[model samples]
Target: MSSIIKLCSSLSSRYNPRLIVSRFTVQPRLCSSVKPSSGPSSSSDHDLKASHKVDNFERKILVWTGKYKSVDEVPKMVSQDTMERARNRMRIKIANYMMAATVVGCLIMVYSGKKAAERGESVSKQNLDWHKSYQAKADKTEKDYASKFEHMAREGAEAAKAN
Candidate 1:
C-alpha cells in the first residue's frame, strides 16, 4: 500500500511540473546600464565626434597617397599602339556606318526621284535632273574627304616619327 501511494503521487507531479518550476526559479529584471538616454545633446555630440574622426582619417589617408592624391592615383596614359588600334577601329566603324548611311540615302533619293519622274514632275528644266546633279556633287565630296583624310594620316605619321 505504501509503494502504491508513492507511485500515484509521482504520476500527479509529473503531469503538473510548471507550478513546481515557477515556485523555485527566480525571474530576471532589466539592467540599468543599457537603458536609453533621456536627452538628445549627448547623443548628437557623440555622433559629431565620430564623424569628425572618420573625416580626419580619410584626409590622412589621402595625404599619405602623395602630395596630390588625385594626381598620384591616376593610372599612366595608354600606350600609343593601344591608342592607334582604338583609333583605327573607331575609324573603320565610322567608315562602315557612313558607307551604310550613304547607300541608304542614295537608295531613298533614287526611289523618290524615280517616283517624281513617273509622275511627270520636272526638276531643274529636266525630269529628275537634280538626282544626277546631287550624285556628281556627292562623288566629288567623297573623293575630296578621302584625299584629305589620307593626307592627314600621312602627316600625322611623319610628325610622330619626327617626335
Candidate 2:
C-alpha cells in the first residue's frame, strides 16, 4: 500500500496537468524510432485462419448442410465444420430472437386488448358498425349517381329527338 501510494505520488508529481501540452497543440516526437511487433495476436489469428482448411472427411458435412450441391463443389481448403457450427449458432440466435419477439408481441396484444375492453371497445361490434356505415354511404352514393344518370339519359333522349 505504501509502495502504491509512493508510485501514485511520483506519477502525480511527474505529470502536472497544467504543464502538459494543450489538446490544440501538436508536438513532434522526440525520437523517430519505431519498434517491431512482438507478433502475439497476429500469430494466433494466422493459426486460426490456417486451421480453416477442411479435411476430405469433413467435406461431406458441408455438402449435407446444403451449402454446396456436392463434395466436388465444396472447397478443398476450407473448414466446413467451423462454417457449419457458425451457421448453427446464427440459426439458434435468430430463432431465440424470433421467439422473444413473438412473446413480446403477444403480451402487447393482450395488454392492449384488456385496455380496450376496459374502454368498452369491442372488435366485432366495431366491425359490424363499420360495415353498416359503409353500406349506408354506398347507398347514398348510388342514389346520387342514379339521379345523375337519369338526368343524363333524359338529355341524351332529347338531343336524339332534336337530331
Candidate 3:
C-alpha cells in the first residue's frame, strides 16, 4: 500500500503542469553564501568555489545563439530585395488604380456629354421661339412711336403755315 501511494504521488507530480513548468524555470539566487559544513575558513573557501562555478554556468547558459546581445543588436528583419519587390508591386497597384480612375472619369464625361446633347436641341428651339416673340413686340413698338412723331410734325407744319 505504501509503494502504491508513493507511485500515485509521483505520477501526479509528473503530470502536474505547474510542477513541470517550475522544474524547468531558473530561479535567481539572492546570495552566494554556502552553508558551513565544517570550520569557518573551509566554509568561506567553499562559498568562493561555489560562486565561481555558478558564474561559469550562468555565462555558458546566457550565450546568444545569433551573436546578438539585444533586439538592437539583431539584424533588420526585412531584406532589401523584399523591400524593392514590395515597392514595385505598390507602384504597379497605383498605376492600375490611376488607369481605372481615368477610364471611369472618361466614361462619366462621355455620359454627361450625351445627356447635354439630348437636352441642347430642345433648349435651342425654346430660345428661337422666345427671340421671335421679342422681335415682333419690338417692331410693333417702333412703328407706334414713328406714327406719333409723324402726326406731331404735321401739326407743327400747319401751325407754321398759318403764322
Candidate 4:
C-alpha cells in the first residue's frame, strides 16, 4: 500500500496542470454572417424543418427520461446517436425491472412449495388420491344403477305374464 501511495505521489508531483492548460489554449470561433450563402431554396428550407423536428423529438425524449426538466432546458442540437443511446438506457432499465420481478415471483413460488412440502402436501400426491376416490365412487354408482335396472326388468316381465 505504501509503495502504491508513493508511486501516486511521485506521479502527481511530476504532473503540471498549468502546463497542460497553457498548451491547450481555447481559440475564438466565427460563424456565418447570418446570411444564406445562396438564395432562398426550397430543399434547404425542407432540410432545416426536418432537422428541427428531429431535434425537438430528441429533446422531448431527454426531458421525459428525467435528463432535463423540460424541452427548453435541453440543447437545441442533439445527435441521433445520442438519442439512440438514451433509448437503449431506458430499455435496459425496463428489462432490469422485469428480470427482478421474475426473480421475486420465482422466489415466492419456491418458498411456498417448500413450505407445502414440509407439511407433506404434494400436488402429485393430491392428484393421485383424488383419482383413486373418484374411480371407486364411479364404480359403486355403476353397480347400483345396474342392479336397479335388473329389478325393473323383472317387474315388467311379471306384469306381462299376469296380463
Predicted structure with the largest TM-score when compared to the true one: 2
Over 4 Å off, model 1: 1-76, 124-163
TM-score of 3: 0.29
Candidate 4: tens digits of C-alpha lDDT, residues 1-163: 6775564456457853122223579433222124437854676664454343346766767776787898888766555565677778778878999999999999999999999999999999999999999999999999999999999999999999999
Q: What is the lDDT of residue 61 in candidate 3?
A: 26
Candidate 3 C-alpha lDDT tens digits along 1-163: 6775565466566754223233779444322234656555665654443332223322322223223354453333333443344456666766899999999999998898789888774567889999999999999999999999999999999999999
lDDT for model 3, on a 0 to 1 scale? Answer: 0.59
The number of residue pairs in model 4 that clash at the backbone is 0
The digit string of per-residue lDDT tens for model 2 on 1-163 reads 6775564456457764223244988444322135767775765665555456676666666665566788888665654456767468667767899999999999999999999999999999899999999999999999999999999999999999999
In model 1, the Cα lDDT at residue 131 comes to 78
CA displacement after TM-score superposition, residue 70 of candidate 4 (Å): 7.0
Off by over 4 Å in 4: 1-64, 67-90
Estimate the Cα RMSD of every predicted model relative to the unseen true structure.
Answer: 25.1, 23.5, 28.8, 16.4
Ranking by lDDT: 4, 2, 1, 3
Displacement of residue 119 (Cα, Å) in model 1 is: 1.5
Candidate 1 per-residue lDDT, tens place, 1-163, comes to 6775564466456744222223779444321225768765765654443332223433333334332265344223333443344446666766899999999999999999999889977566574577789999999999999999999999999999999
Whole-model lDDT values for every prediction = 0.59, 0.72, 0.59, 0.72
Q: How accurate is candidate 2 locally (lDDT)?
A: 0.72
